[model samples]
Target chain A: MTTKFTPDHEYIRVEGSTGIVGITPYAQEQLGDIVFVELPAVGKALKKGDEAAVVESVKAASEIYAPVTGTIVEVNSLLTNEPGLVNSDPEAAGWMFKIAISDASELDTLLDADGYAELTL
Target chain B: MAEVPTEDLKHTPLYERHVTAGGRIVPFGGYALPVQYPTGIMTEHKWTRDNAGLFDVSHMGPGFLTLNTPSGDAETDHAAIAAIIEPLICGDIAGLKPGQIRYTLLLNESGGALDDLMVARSKTPGTLFIVVNAGTKEGDFARIAAAAGNKATLKRADDNALLALQGPEAVNVMAALVPPAADLGFMQFGEFDWNGTPVTISRSGYTGEDGFEILAPAHMSVALWDELLTDPRVRPIGLGARDSLRLEAGLPLYGHDLDETVSPIEADLGFAVSKRRREAADFPGAQRILAERDGKLSRKRVGLLVEGAPAREGAEILDALGTAIGVVTSGGFAPSLGKAIALGFVSPEHTAIGTKLQVSVRGRSQPAEVVPTPFVPHRYFRKSV
Candidate 1:
């Protein structure tokens, strides 16, 4: 039920074995405008720190790394039509995908809200 | 992106202003410049298209090319000076009229573009203003200066600062500060005295939208920039929007779209090779350039409307059978077009408008179609008189 963060600037909102993942607001702010988001397909197995998705801005493109090892169960296809939504509401509606957590212990390796806020600062 | 080494980077006159205005400073062309302001590049780009955007372009090499010997008759002196510079570039410099500007390319002996630049003829006849790319300025100046010998003197105006005010509302803003600036037709420039310092303003810019470029003394430029921004119609822009604007305009950037290995003909800049220069075949690289004019080039620059992910620079362009035909030189989302668009090179056979192709983005082939460029129409001011 708590949100955890990674040093690479991804967030995982834990919900049982399924978790929703997205990039942090700090990452989006640094990225400027989000012109395109290339996400992994559903059922794609991803390892922790693996290249999970891509976020492209008007200036350049950056890789979005996975925070924990899991398999993508659902993707936020809404990003295709409205990429700017990530800039507007990166935390909620801009969530990139849902992953079926393969290992609960991997969540411990990530930072909590307090730790993430400090890391961003 | 890799940070440009801090040791070699320089700062412009407006460097402090950019920091004060919440600009995301980055190293570009060996200068510390703002890539975008707090409003972001997309907003700034739209502002320039609909209203006005002010850009700091002091990093560009803006200097004067004047005759070392002053002949009493200004007309005669200018033609002679133009002749000295004409031999070094592909443009017809001798045919330029007073207050006119011509876009041309400095070429290598093998017909490749050294750098694309703008040459502006001053009304004073013996003098001409030259603007070159920041990255190539040092070498370009040295080359031109060495070639000038005693006939002309190439004065490197590092003390000057350049700014571009672009948009549909650009004229309205410039007219308020200096009325004569609005009267200038596209590709024309004139000097005006405002307050105490003189400012050279030209009805030319990189954006496809109508605009004016102002050249002023380095010390006086900050004041002029402040004065222009006081107008409610104008917003400060950064280099991020500048690249997108020019790309949409179908303008070739020196280092990216053009380089020492790419010829002007292959880059789709044949118009810059003047009518007289074509017939005379007298300018540098004219022999190979003229030969390429009639003959088929191996590849050509073309615009693409990408259907999927934005195809970026260096993406491989593919033909119908998934064969790599060419590579993209500059590609990104066109803010005005509201779709992903790209500029890439392809075999001549695949360059026709509406020709279908594919671009490999992240190892997946995406659908692309060749389209007529300037992805947007240019709106330059043309005087009736």
Candidate 2:
């Protein structure tokens, strides 16, 4: 139940064949306030590195990329009402979606906690 | 292929403090200012609305003006200075009692606004303190100097730094530092000493709140800022929250809402032009401004509650039938109102509140309606002593 982070600040925690994906705390901190979260629709297929969501802050807008290829199964509905959760707990409670992994091998491309921290620094 | 140095971006004196507080620094008005801190802009914004927020407005220009004549008498200097500057602005400078402040606009000969500034007649006799925008200060000074024509002396207060302590709880935090600040009503300024350093504190702010703006010597600014942050009610806010706060208040930013091509009458700021000044018709563009006031204006500034998505600056505003009517001067998602709002100058025919309109953003037309300003009501303190 450990999450892997991408150098770009996305986190992927695998649960069986499906993985929950969201941005890391570092990413949310850099983005400032999260005003809007444009999540991918359920059942939409995504490729590794493909844009999965758009997070708009008061200062800027950035695209959230998929860390592993899969089809989106569920999205975080809570973001619509309280986007600040992303800043509050970006990797855990702020997970954007659950995706059925189409290619488990894509997980190798992401970094572990230590590697992600180094990349951010 | 060359990497730019971090110093290439401008930094204010409190840059280190912002970074230490986990603030996200961003380029704004040519300086690297904190946009928000770790708590995030929304929380920071809401916190300011409910509590108190300290803003580093040091980049703003604070300067003084005095009569050019060497009369050596404060009373004579005050009369000469007021008379000389009154004809150039829309406000009744002569009527400005000591310690009184007035918001006025500098106009071009063609009836366009050069800049909107705050002018405060000092209680120390003969001195008028003015605050102008950071981005447009240089041009504003040049224009003011040229208009003064050796009749007044304009001295830029480079040694001073400005800070805004805003929100409902601002008075509580500031009252501890300067006891008399709680008694001053909105738009009123007075001199006080903080730890032996003289300061000018005004009960006015860009945010629609009961707050105070403090101007002190640059060296003393950091000390005062540190002292204020000790209060649990006061947290440092950055430019991000500042923008949303002002937007919710529906205040016009100089370059965006009021510009060289926009006249006061057309910008819905005719109130700033007093009846005496209007009748005198001696200020620059007075004739054209008065004509516009008399219903001769073709376009007028109006507020818009945009539907669909946020329409940003330069977005084209359209009439009900889809014809271009105006352009959005300032538009954003108002954190306080929880909706997208915009300010623009639509044709006079379409300026009525509730008038249906459309705004084109990124090639998409979104429905909008003309609305009144200050998306949020101003909560300035009014002491009934």
Candidate 3:
């Protein structure tokens, strides 16, 4: 699996044509303790950078954008009752949704791990 | 969150300490203060409820109003000082016992609140200590100073660092640092010597916790802060937790829950309108304020227990039939309760406790119900007589 990130700090891990999307650890850290997460429903179509979900911390709310255009195949239901998972394990079990890639070429426009690391720094 | 360029923001004395401690600096009230430390708002908030939370509230306006000329008789001097300020607010400053603090509202000519503030009768017979909100300091000070005219002088002390050590263990920390200050009853304040420098400490705080607010010289502030943090029970809390704590405490923040256009009665702060001031009908906007008190008010502020996603500021409040009633002033997740809560104004008829309501978040209506606030009970320390 290859992981790519957006300048807004969302990460999409791709396995074949399917991609799992979630906010990066750095993004969660900046956002502080997660109190609530509002996710898009399954079967929803999203364009690149569309506001796909909302992550709320104790102080404020932030939007999580889609990394690339695709159709949402699944959403992390665990977040409904356990939002803190995003703060504790943002990259793994905290994954927000799964999207089926509609345009493979869009993945090439996302930043690589090295590029995202430099951007955060 | 929108970033305010650091170059344009003023730095508090604790700015460097916050940075060194891994605090996320943010612009608030025109100052560069920490929104949260590395431990985050939830941890800092819970730590405060369970232990002690040290906060830098220096951005607030703390000042003294002293009679320009005291006649040497304590009562006469106090009356003279109080007379100069009573016209500007709805609190009976003249009735305050020495060293006692009263929360009061600064009202405009129309009876709308200009700002809510704390006014204290200083032990020094001719002086009064006042603290106003940070965002409204400049205008508030100017107004107070102008109102004082030649009879009294409003001495601005915003340059001083104001620290609040709050929580259940706050008194214990103070007892160890300054023994005399710990004996103060809730809402009382006194000047004490901290080592060599003089410090004014009040047995009061915004958090619904037993705590103290200390006003100390800027140069000695860092040393005092370092000394306090040495206590294992004390942690440096940021503005993020401070906001949550006050929200749970059901306190109306100056700019959000309160504004220049909100009257004391409409804002659910009628208690701040002193009985003496009400009877005399001498405070600003007394005519309108008294009318509102007598059931002429249209809307009233109420607390809501929201289900599902947090309803943020500007969210619409709706009735059971899905008709809009009002707008939320302040809404967020209450760390102490583990649920979303909000403060909003709705038609007076719909404000009774347990009234079913709804809040539109992102165009979707969510279940909400009117509930008594101080979402968590206030644990202020009141000494038993």
Each candidate's DockQ score against the native complex? 0.68, 0.29, 0.81
Candidate 3 has an fnat equal to 0.79
Sort order, TM-score high to low: 3, 1, 2
Backbone clash tally (model 2): 0
For residues A28-67, what per-residue lDDT tens digits would candidate 3 score against the true structure? Answer: 9889899999999999999998999999998788999999
Rank by lDDT (best first): 3, 1, 2
In the range B264-381, model 3's lDDT, one tens digit per residue, is 9999998999999999999999999899999999889999999999998899999999999999999999999999999999999999999999999998999999999889999998
Name the best candidate (by DockQ).
Answer: 3
For residue B97, what is the lDDT in candidate 3?
90
lDDT tens digits, residue span B1-385, model 1: 3335655679999999999999988888889899999999999999999999999999999888888887868779888888878888999888888889999999999889999999988988789888899999998898889888988889987668899999999999988989878899999888887787898888999998899999889998899999999999999999999999998998888888899988889999999999998888888787778877886588788999998788999999998789999999998888898888888888888989999999999899999999998899999888753
Using lDDT as the yardstick, the better of models 1 and 3 is: 3
Candidate 3 lDDT score at position B254: 88
| DockQ of candidate 3 compared with the true complex | 0.81
- lDDT winner between candidates 1 and 2: 1
Candidate with maximal lDDT: 3
Docking category of candidate 1: medium
TM-score of the A-chain for all models: 0.97, 0.95, 0.98
